[model samples]
Target: MSATTPNGAPASQPKKTPQIPKGKTELKILMLHGYTQSGPLFSSKTKALSKLLTKALSPAPYNLHPTLIFPTAPHRLRPSDIPGYTPSDGAEGAEAEEDDESDNWAWFRKDEATGTYLGFEAGMRAVATAIADAGGVDGVCGFSQGGAVAALVASALEKPHREPAPSPSPETDTSWLPLLRAANNDAPLKFCVVYSGFYAPPPTLGWLYAPPIATPTLHFLGSLDTVVEESRSQGLVDRCVDPTVVVHPGGHYVPVAKDWVLVLAGWLRKRYDEPAGTAKKEEGNL
Candidate 1:
């Protein structure tokens, strides 16, 4: 029988509604802040980026949703330790031992001569504790020095294909391994996001890069960034087995504009939708 809408004429069929994919589980990402910045500070800075990601990836075309975790570094920094430090006019030029501001922190102190991080183990352990407490993560995202740590942390989670697993170096602290293992639950690191990141030039850190990490990496480089220098960020790209590069027209800060954020969403969508090592497929296009 034909149905009518209060008339003899037959009612037209209703148009079909579009179906949207809903992800079964949300992937977790541990976020690391840049030097002289705490997790909370960085989180505040990235609110725009996070909001854009949610809008772009949570419905319709892209179904991937990510939960981000931000944890503070364990090391407290002195005024001298921070970049762009300026001594006060008082005290006959004698410096204050501690900064009154509570937010001062660093993932590690740089040894300019040797190109080594003085407290990498302590800093990484602090990060690991945060992840372990959060019940693990699927990826890591970081900025500047934190971005460098993201790469190192990813490499550390990866077991070298052929190695005896030797002891930690004399200059480096290895206490982070236990917590790192706990944070990852013995699973491979799925992906890493680096903003204005660089390669760790120290000989002690060679192990982390020698094997060439296979985790899908999305690296953001600022064309005008004087702090991390383009060469340094490129050096990191050269070390990764597969990396997705996004160049922004700005400086040291993370670009949170719609265009940049959408680029990130697209990369992340591919990360979730495609298998590992397939990132190279889109290399030419990017």
Candidate 2:
């Protein structure tokens, strides 16, 4: 079946086939793309990695099959062009142009100063709905800005939403409290994979708190990444409650390194092989 927007725009819903390597247990992996790109863009770009992952997880010495779910970002465009929002050349340019013609989209607005995202709650909710519609997910993987958004989405899911209480006194300070309450009421997410991501909180918006996430996570950063410095990615990794970092020698793009596909495949294999009860127990604890 095809997926389409309310306006009949083409969407990225892939036909559900029996998970590859039938008879083996399957895990659902939701992959989100970086800025200026759609789900199908990443899905096509990461085909090699996905194939490698499927092979690596096969039973015997390794037996596993993961059904990857790629969800398109909700279409959006800046009302006015913002500086530093232009796409780079080559594949990036092609993807950006395609998205632009379709009405350029972004998961959230980027804060130029700290690189933190703003107005991400709406995108997060959309992603959550997509995942639920796709039959839930065993794990999530994202690249660059997608990575930052994924982390925030995972954090949001772990807390329960609470209505903000109004303060009678004008002198009273209740700014941060409301945000904290909202973030404290979300659902729990499983493992996450972040590539070339930054971890700055939103400016003056206490709603964008980065709680100590307990989900197992894998972080990949390019040593030569200028767009998102390795130091920044490392900082985010350090803040994660439990995370493993892998440093690749290259630039910002994931396909630049030859071994990245292998590395990512291995990570996915490990994530999808965890006992079913473990995920359930973790969800319960959250």
Report the alpha-carbon TM-score of model 1 versus the true structure. 0.84
Per-model lDDT? 0.77, 0.62
Residue range 1-286, candidate 1, lDDT tens digits? 6443231212323423323346535667889999888777888999999889878778755465667778777677777776787766773235553444345677889888876778887788777777776677888999998999999888888754322246465545666776687677867677899999999987766777877877778899998999998889999999998678888999998999999998888887786666765756875464
Off by over 4 Å in 2: 1-17, 78-100, 111-118, 159-187, 203-211, 256-258, 269-286
Which candidate achieves the best TM-score against the true structure? 1
Q: Per-residue CA lDDT of candidate 2, range 55-169, in tens?
A: 6666655566777777776645542333365555465656545543553456677667766455565556557656766656667788887887766656545545322235444
C-alpha TM-scores of all predictions: 0.84, 0.70
